[model samples]
Target: MNNVKSLNKWANAHTYLPVDVLRMALGVFLFMKGVYFVSNIQYLVDLISPIEKIGGGMFLLHYIAPAHLVGGILIFFGLLTRWAIIAQLPILICAIIINFMGFMHHQNLLLALLSLGVCVFFLIYGSGKNSADYFFKMEQ
Candidate 1:
């Protein structure tokens, strides 16, 4: 009986529940940020001008919003998480590139870089514990 109780306690300690919660939170946050950009189409449009003169256009902003929205949803729900992270990587990289190329200085570019770094962390580590990946692996 003592051994059984100890094993139960150990299992509880090793559970990945926290990781799943964190992953969902991050995904929801990113998703909402992206949705906000989409909802405020004008902001993206205005950004197009400055970026377009540097060879980018409104289309880029238009595309990014959807990617954020979709990626966020996927990551949040642990559905196709790997694919979602991979998809968003390009969008994040483009934001960094566009910011650097179009800005007068590097402040915005730095911000973009930071944002990209965060995304990269998620992409690499994933929602490790308690995530769909974890459950999926265990089931297999």
Candidate 2:
């Protein structure tokens, strides 16, 4: 916990505008993906259909869109960013697995990997100085 606090302090001190913008872009991408998933529910269902025998596949199905939606908003606003990204990580991991289960869609795999990478980055770097998390902490 002490190490985590020190890392966070270092990350916050080193943040830059470009990094914040990157975070915003990642958030937007996730939000748009959520919207896409919501609009094309059938596609997502079909994608995960093969995994239905796994017991909790359907349950996981219900989590994806909402996680992306809520998590994206939280990440975009830089509020509880690590928590939001943590929520997204599992979904992204499943996405990667699903992409390979049936058909190897290189594009989808690439996108998932990229998103996962960004999420991992934010998970460590935090919301930075321009984030709502920082703002609220400062107020307190």
- The estimated TM-scores of all candidates read 0.67, 0.95
Candidate 1 residue spans exceeding 4 A from truth: 1-22, 53-61, 104-111
How many steric overlaps are in each model, in order?
0, 0
- Displacement of the residue 31 alpha carbon in candidate 1, Å: 0.9
Q: For residues 68-108, could you state the per-residue lDDT of candidate 2 as single tens digits?
A: 99999999999989999999998899889888787888998
Q: Write the per-residue lDDT of candidate 1 for residues 1-140, one digit (tens) a residue.
A: 57634543454356577656766876886788788887888876754555567655655876778888898888887776767888888776766666656654476567557667766666555555456655675698
Q: Tell me the TM-score of model 2.
A: 0.95
Candidate lDDT values, in order: 0.69, 0.90
